[model samples]
Target: MPASTREAVRTAVLADSDTRWKWGALTARRITPESVEPTGFVLRGRATPTARQLTETGVSDTAPREVTGAEFLREVRDAEARGEGYDVVVLALVGGAVRALLQGLADLGLARRPVIVTGYVGVVYEKLTDGLLLRHGADVVLANSRHDAERFRAVYEGVGASAEPVVEAALPFLGGAPHTPEAGRDTLVFAAQPSVPATRAERAYVLRRLVGHARLHPDREVLLKLRSKPGEHTTHLEEFPFQKLVRELDAPANFRLVYGHMGEVLDRTDLLVTVSSTAALEALHRRVPTAVLTDLGVREALGNHHFVGSGLLTSFDLLDRGLVPAPDETWLARQGVAADTPYEAAFDAARERVAALLALPALPPVTPYYTAETAPGYLPGVLARHRLDVTAPEPRESGLRRVVREAARGAYRQGVQRVAPVIRRLGEL
Candidate 1:
């Protein structure tokens, strides 16, 4: 390909706040507009409302561009005609839609050479489908964790495709000035929202255990910081039996509900508690002692047990035995998680892998970008209640938008309500 032509063709296949920010900051590639015909389109399997929200807020060119199944099939055909046009197709997808998407891609002959970023592991069908995609088309598959990376590597051993870890760090919003730590407060927070019935049962059991432990140690305070989500004020709050539990038991004076200011809430807590939720990872990495509540069968099935089995996780069993793993003092001293090499080195390695995928006669590299200024309809705008230009207002905000802003408060209340009864009941146990 000629230099000028290659440069002209190197536009982003998908343009959204995250895609634009992630890829744009890393490389000079412009976010592809809906108006412009791409050499080929890249599709992610997950219907990530957040990604769509990013696109809705930040992506320029407001024309309504509806991509139907047929239109997508046509785009692939067009790309195929312009041979050597697309580096490769990429799909970061999961669940039922994956089959239809892959089948469609295959029918169009687009699945012959592409890259696939697989989601979490353990679902056999999803893993097998991902492996098949890799063998048939993918040049590179991105895993979000070291465990996920190793899992994918095992699945596709000896296959042409390769797996690499891309740890999902919290966005810059999380890095805002760390609040001052709260001293001498003995609180434990369960930050996850259990959406399923089975999960609720497990959570109930864990709360019971924690309450029992709290009763035995009357000197210590037990605080529950529950986050609220969409429909939470109605469903979760109403269904959870906090008030009833309080009425039933001779409650400890220290057991109270704390909400709001998550960083502060966490700072006050002696430790964080959860099932197989990512909050465990966040808490430990940030120097908070973490306990994995393993009695939850659902969480255990989802690989929470592995963390407990690993030295990294301190289990509820240990906590019941009066154990508390010290905070990651090394990371706290350095003010960051451990890396054998510096961040720049890890980034360099990531860039090399991305470059390798791009250089492959098969797939285009994902160039991620971030800018300090707000673009039209960008995330900052949506979150801040401003327009894309960072000026006007939209009529309504998304449910998720509301949730992220208010989750800590809601979760804290719910956790207190749910745990109070269990604590009182522990005497019977």
Candidate 2:
């Protein structure tokens, strides 16, 4: 309530590295940790062993602290009692964890801490869960484009929340020095998503379409760029990974399975093809011609509603027939990528929001719940059942450590084989 007691927090979430870094730098100007916890980050959900999410974001594996739901409430209460309550809590959660975390906080009688909800995925407003969270829990929600901000405003009105919090912030990762464009190379990158081919049947259809497309355009290079390795558990619950499917294909020389970051992959991509994956947005940002294969449509599991109205939406059949479409200028204008807005202006817009948010008085305490109003339907059933009742993941060995451990085991097996005859003779004696 007082300027002396004002505090700010940014949850050190794995998926929110850009937001965390941007806000962390902005807040350092006005708020210092010694004065009043400038950036007090709390752990939210558990990470899968194969996820390696934290490592991917450059978040340290050390110093992760855990607290039960009730314990969390006590911490909030304790902070308030000691006159050190946080003024703002920045949230950039990737999944339903935000709702689960919010529900727990609400149950504990959430201290008047304003929550800022954000997302990195484009066309996420396609999911109603975000609208529900914005309406019920979040005081503010960041939008990457004026188009998305308007959509967020519509959702807020739909849920009877104020549109004032739906503010425009440039997509953080879209900015930076442009790499050498893959123009003239005629390279087609199939931004392989786990969602496009959710089942084996869908997988077969998409792969067949891609290979067919490549055959028609033999001069072009077709790369199946995977989001993760064969077994990594990403946000997409992939049943049949494309990495595994490549082995069965009667592959051409140009057909290759590439593993790496989307940014790195985009370095050489000329024409980007996808089943309405957000990678299209990256291709757009990079000024590459992208085509959204509406072959799957919005029905069943292959939902690509985000690419609606974007001029790039095409059919896999069209690609198979060797027809490439250009991105719509109107759609590009609507997206408001870094190219459209000056980098300094976009960066400043985000920083200004944080500066103004933290300057506000402590937020009114909230009564947390676990219904659709609190948690989005997108959350895991197990997580929904245990809202706020969560456990933090213990830090684990890095991928390198795991590889070293496996190598040592292999060496031991070879040594044991060499001594097998001697052990058998000793046992007889």
- State each candidate's clash count: 23, 2
lDDT of 1 by residue, 1-429 (tens): 321234433322331113322222222121111113333232321121232333332323332222433454455556557764344333323322333344445445553333332232211212353343323223334443344445556654444333342322111112223224565556667654333223445556656666776787776777765443222331122344342334445556666655444455666666777655454544654556677654555343455554533344565677767786654444332322333333333234333444454445544332211112322333233223311111123235499976774565445654554555467567769
TM-score of 1: 0.50
The weakest ten consecutive residues by lDDT in model 1 span: 26-35
Error of 2 at 108 (Å): 5.5
How well is each residue in 123-146 modelled by candidate 2, as lDDT tens digits? 553455453453345554666677
Clashes of 1: 23
Winning model by TM-score: 2
